[model samples]
Target: MAKGAHGSRQAAWEFFGAELKRRREEAAFTQVELGARVFVSGGYIGQFEQAIRKPQLDVAQRIDETLRTDGFFERMWRKLIKDLPFEAYFAHVAELERLATKICQFEPMLVPGLLQTPEYTRALYEVSHPFATPEYVEEQIQARMDRARILKDATRPEYWVILHEAALRVPVGDPITMAAQLDRLREMVGEHKVLIQVIPFVAGAHTRMGKMMKLMEFEDAPPAVYTEGVHWGNLLDEPGVVKQVQGSYDLLRAAALPPEASLILIKTAAEDHRRCAKST
Candidate 1:
């Protein structure tokens, strides 16, 4: 039987969960029996089957081995691992992003992760996780970098990003790192990999300030709106809510500078950062 056919249509993770359940049953293993082989509780297996939880990489691998599925679960786990480094609440959003046909995002404070350079990503992680071990920090940086691969995929999504002027101005690291970050944005804009609009400081406050919002449109699923805070995030999929948020994002995009002008502003900011680094 096809995955997810046993239940209402849902996200890819849910489909994966359904497939896991089907395979377990075909192998004549009860949830408890499977959990014993995977070293997790029967309840955890139930959560996986119901798509209420995601399996860790190790757990997925163990399940694959126990079920003799020839690495089927492990292969699916690799695609899902792109969600790593994100909070658990937002993992599904990451998966959605990977599968999206188009993505639009607004960032008020920092550069979007998809556009961040490795150096820039590292600096952000170091500051945010002040007490994290070097290994952990490196692991997170790698995961962030890995997420960028979606932008380079054969079927890359059409990306449109609206960045607040404050995000460009605030120095995440030293002048050099900031300059490189800005240059990176300029380079991507030049390459036409993404469409960028800058909400200039002169434009003043507008709709959807003080929070980061991303709207993702998928080819096979309904659109989603994601909003995030420092330690938490919400993925909104209700049709009414998604429509409202999409309208707000459209307004914000209209209020921002045009792409040509935004590119200039970004390049100018990069030059200014370079000059500041030279003077200091």
Candidate 2:
């Protein structure tokens, strides 16, 4: 039977635990026997089967070897890992991206951060990682591009993004690439699932926080807010606190143009970039 969304997440936990239990039982091994093979206590084996403890790589390998299932744990690891090159920082973002029913993003940097073009993102990363080799930059760009692909899937989440005017004025790459990136932004506005807003520099200082923020609403879970900088992100899910952050977002939206006007502003900026590219 097809499971509902909430059921599916819960089912993943159960399914993973049950798989461990089934493998042990199928091998004619009791909890104590399996623990002996894997160099763990019987209580740890029981906990593994009960979804109370996640397996480390070494333990996972030991468990797989004792069960004689070649690469079972490795296969599961691939499934558990998201397409993230940034590791710990991206983990929370990955979960939110997967579960978000609606996402409201406010980006102070160029474009909505998630919708950033490879050329633009590379330039930004390059500034931050000036010491990074070419290969490292490519890795980051590929990771970001892969992250963006989630929105292309049939189950794409609803996305509404607000971009500060400063984001529009900043040229991340060379003029040509900048213009192409702007054009891409313009084209993306046509996507029915995305709402893009450009808050002009002329809007002046309102809720002038220097970083970006995302408000994610979920199906069965309470909404959360995310803020990221450099190497870390904080996810706020506390009840009353999330409400206040959302209220702040509401006021921030008021400081920016409505959807229609925001579109016009974005298109005009794209056209200006195109003109600049041609002149240069």
Candidate 3:
């Protein structure tokens, strides 16, 4: 079985590659010895590190049990299966989310994609995308909803969002639907599990409004950043690029309302909407 067989094209071979290298080190085996144990060529191991390909399940299981990694590879395999239909662009983002220890998201426009309520998400999508007809809308909804599971996974990672004020004020769909959406945001904030900060309209002349981004950190690799525009997305791996994005986000965080303050703002907005709904 080829490395791609395990993941096919779920988008983060580099992560799988890093995991393989880390396990090999923990097992105290050279690539040649580890490869021999798994019946893979030593060069195959090299390629896995290069992320040119990944190892198959049979090989993955052998290494996992031998190194006592305790189902890391097995669980990874399962997650990859669920994300099989991920688009190439989405696949890359999904992979980062999978391996991330912590994720910091900045939605200079709408709510961060991962934390969006279904109705709000659909509203945003419908406005931006002309291609999502009724049939496609449902498909897109399922795909978007699927991402919410990551927040509840056993390996649940920390989530932090910096939502721009415009994202909250602009009523998507309608006032009623937008009210429900704000209420959903309030509920999530109440859990105390996710932290949210609002970048007010007052904080003018900011950086990167046209592009939204997520900063992902993994156990093995250095942290990396991803930014997306209206159509295409770009991943930044270089240390300099990572630093720039991280710094910009840090500045954004400083300029925005603190988490606790943001929660109050969100809750107040929700209540105001509910009251208006009753009066109508």
Candidate 4:
């Protein structure tokens, strides 16, 4: 049997569980009754309602059907697990990315997650999770690829990125992979999907020079800033802090190369990587 949960910081799964419990009660059905309708054991249903276990998609759909909630539980399940591979604290940030009206990012070391290619992403996970199973790594890679679909939507958010020159030059996976990633960046620019600028080494130290920052503005919610360390991330929605971070991001953007020049620089770096790959 799974342990029940009641806590201060309720995760999305917990919220979904609470909602499920409420609906089940309102329908006057016992856990055993609901479990039978969903083809699961009563104990399992109890665990799910308590958020001790996350329901699988099919199970969640069945529960929704049983409760006649018209897919509410199913949709919540999908949103709750959209980025299962990310850290727990970063879940809200992932959700914000999908719904934000505008996204501005400063990447100091590697390609932004939204822009990284599968090959590059795989390489990163492999390095960071040296002991992870190959199957697990592949699952994470697929999740990241799925996240990229947000960029393809016609109603996608406006994206602006400022990448440090080092991110373009660093060899991830191999030179060929790096070149492909750079080419992808160039293609996104050409398609007008995103505007990118490069902060060259010559710019010296500036605001947010050592850390990565993402500022998101939403249509309905207040703006937020997300900053991450090696293993943890913080999402700040306080207006004063968000304003200060936004101001710093603006300064960094001003110091970086303009879009046209940045494109040239990116292409040149891509060519250099291509040559290196050929030589290797």
| Top candidate, metric TM-score | 1
Candidates 2 and 3 compared by TM-score, better number: 2
TM-scores for all candidates? Answer: 0.74, 0.70, 0.70, 0.73
Per-residue C-alpha lDDT of model 1 across residues 1-280, encoded as one tens digit per residue: 1224213334766878999999999999999999999987787798788776567667899999999988998888676554346566666676677778999999998999999998998899889999999998888777777778788778989999999999989999898999999999988888878999999999988998877999988764567788998788877766899999989998999889999999899989988988999999
- What Cα-based lDDT does every candidate model obtain? 0.84, 0.74, 0.74, 0.84
Model 3: per-residue Cα lDDT over 1-280, one tens digit each: 1236435553565677788788788778888888888786676688667775445556678878877889887677556645554554456566567678899888866777677777887887788777778877767777777767677677877888888888777667766777788777777777654788998778886877656889988765567688876566776656789989999889888888987788777777677766777887
In model 4, the clashing pairs are: none
Question: Which residue window of length 10 is worst by lDDT in model 1?
Answer: 1-10
Candidate 2 per-residue lDDT, tens place, 1-280, comes to 1125335644565676799999899999999988888877776688667654444456778888888889887567455544235565556465567667789988887676568888888888888889999998998887677667668878788998888877777788777777777677767777775787777778788674576888888765567788887787777666798788777778778888987888787767777877888887
Where is model 1 more than 4 Å wrong at Cα?
A: 1-16, 19-85
TM-score of 4: 0.73
Off by over 4 Å in 2: 1-83
User: Arrange candidates by TM-score, highest first: which order?
Assistant: 1, 4, 2, 3
Better of 2 and 4 by lDDT: 4
